[model samples]
Target: MTRFPSQTPHGEISEVFSDVFFVTGSVDMMPGFRISRSMTILRDGDILTLISPVRLSEAGLKGLDVLGRVENIVKLGSYHLGAHNGLDNPFYVDRYGAKLWALAGMEHKGGLSTDHILKAGGDMPTRDLSLFVYESSKMPEAMFVLNREDGVVIAADSLQNWSEVDEFFSEAAANAMTKGGFIRPANIGPEWKRHCAPAPAEFEKVSKLPFRHLLPSHGTPLLNTAKTDLVQTFSHQFS
Candidate 1:
């Protein structure tokens, strides 16, 4: 089986913060839609933690080598585990309770397993990084917070920022996503709510967190005023 749908000649790695970088790749989800998968790299000293990993090409691997040695692989939820095939990483981690519920389904679907289960307030491989369980969504999802001078929240699938469809998107898919409320900037994922049945109170609690940058797996990163944007975007759902 193909590890990835397609590989870019060079992984498009962009620095989000001092020691944080992101790579974007394509995923074959909808026929006409150009769905994207993002991999977030958090570098601590000479060690790196890969979150929601995507398969990279030879040049991409070279790009990653410039960063640091990859020490750990993390899947924020079950839905983000598709591209983790054949990775010989040292450590792997998943959501705390996902093994109890998602492991069977993942095994049946030929997905990989985690070496460690992560929980909120638990220790991560990297220092100054913390995990939080998004209790609002029924699906087992975890969000990471980088406690730096400027706080950053690394989100999985719940919060998206698909401002506009890119060149990879088919016209039909773009239209469908826009109409389905999936292509908005800094908004809750429509399909996630439909499938996971999230509660607004959970997001209300999230809105109160002091995060300035929002790095989502699906869309562009909100560099500034991310908390305010999140509150304004989904506050109505809370009420």
Candidate 2:
């Protein structure tokens, strides 16, 4: 299994404002293997609620800057808050960001410092957006829930990425991810399990969605039975 390097290319892809219009970009892997990163922009006129911004270049930053007023930004997970430290933007971190806020200190990228701390009601105002907070830890990993009527779930590191994580990692890294509480073999670890656990209950919450598609932060967006495959894979590991 060949490992693919990170290829988000740093830019704005698409956005969804409150008016029911959606815009996004495609993230890809090497050659035929590619994927797209997502940044949700929920807007009410000049007010923009940005999801996670990618590693954009100078020009890409210009494009992202041109997109909207971008008042408040939200980071959905620990890893999702990647290397854009110098970005002097206001950020709101739900439970996930609060858990990983210390990381912003290590590298000078991502949600450096901003107004508004993350709290429970974060999802209520963003009702048009989908919200999935899987209990990955006491800190919890943030999973983006698409507020679309379709009900798709946009997962960051929780679902990681197939192409981003090679089959080799799935085999060898399983032990490490298992111990680190990110993933497990066949079944999942109690630490990062969904809806904070018991598996079945997590399955129930996921099943309630009318959507079958998955938009992951890395690799590719999955459709068809990929959703079921991922669920079953995680379920099998539940102990």
Candidate 3:
């Protein structure tokens, strides 16, 4: 019985803003084809909420313990529900006795262990976080806006900022993603866009959200210029 998909290589947790931390990791898409992904952790007092989780090493877990207790594990996107790569929602739930908050329609994916259903205007992990659902996407997808630190967005697969292929990306994956248009800056997720086909109006509304920075699950964090950069993408994507 695999306690979790053999722990993959991931970076140490980094405090991007106050108690908001970020970590980078890789997901083996196939043999010799691994791509980079990320996770965001938010701490409010002694409680911590993990969004788009990635399994960490034993030392990394100790570092996480130093931050706070893992109280809530949130899954914002319906597509990546531990189905591919290392989402690690169930492992954290079993290990920490944490609640899993997942999108309403994702249960069919199996193995989700959904303790709470995530929906617009429903219960959130923290008061400072607000949910923004893509109401028209083929699959359930959403983002969170942290009310503090000039507003930081915690995104899943919809928004991305993969400016370049970093070390986490295997050369095979890098070349493949680059050809598929997955390697770009401040861009809509090419795979998500092609599969989900979310309506243009969804992004139109996203551009208006009061967020300055975006910490996406699939790319480098877009700081300060997130809104400005995304607005450009929306103009091109939705105009």
Candidate 4:
């Protein structure tokens, strides 16, 4: 039952029913776009997978109080970990961003618990969890899938959410998915296509999952046909 702001180390929770939920926090990254992101609240029996950490401001955290004692906090990638509040679970990451996550901690506080590598095969969410980590065509991108009954799949930088982007980007540059926010193949999302390079094999592995929808950290989530769009997005990414 802890709370964070949309731009600070705060969180907000909203259940979309059927155990599928959404939690968002506000943030103040830098120049433009005062962002507000939500983490998909997923629960598989006892294991809770918080999708993405939303930026939370001090006042924002005070407003949207969230309650969820997550058994684990699974970070999608290194840059994505900025949303991490203070959960003491085993930190996990795909290949590309683990070192950065670790360095960020070392340079700032001290360090984090050893991070688990999200490799193929072991990357699948399995047993109703349906977790899938694609070594994206962009960076060391990692995504999640929780199955039909579970009703949620947390997409990291793979989905370019224009709806949300419009709010962040000025009216002139809204569709700048390739510029800033999530998975921007063109030049969006602020993430360069380097460092932890994308692994096509990884994306293929995740492409064959049965997810009902996708909930991304940046932009708007692919609510209904998230699985399809997710697969297509990656397909075109490598194609």
TM-score of each: 0.82, 0.53, 0.95, 0.60
lDDT of 2 by residue, 71-141 (tens): 45555555342333222222223211322222111232442553443443363334555456554333345
Q: Candidate 1: what lDDT?
A: 0.66
Clash counts for all predictions? 0, 28, 0, 29
Check candidate 3 and list the clashing pairs. none
| Tens-digit lDDT track of model 4 for 1-239 | 13322234434455665666665544444444345445665666654445554433445334323333343445565545343432222222221122212211211112445344455446333245544554354334555656564366566544444343433433334434334444332212345234346556765665566666566665555566655665766666678
- Among all windows of 10 consecutive residues in model 1, the one with the lowest summed lDDT is 95-104
Candidate 3 local distance difference test against the native = 0.84
C-alpha lDDT of residue 156 in model 2:
49
The top-ranked prediction according to TM-score is 3
Q: Which stretches of candidate 4 lie over 4 Å from their true place?
A: 1-12, 31-33, 44-49, 55-68, 81-110, 115-127, 135-141, 164-195
Model 2: which ten-residue window has the lowest total lDDT?
95-104
Candidate 3, 65-84: lDDT as tens digits: 99999999888887652357
- Sorted by lDDT (best first), the order is 3, 1, 4, 2
> Model 4: which ten-residue window has the lowest total lDDT?
100-109
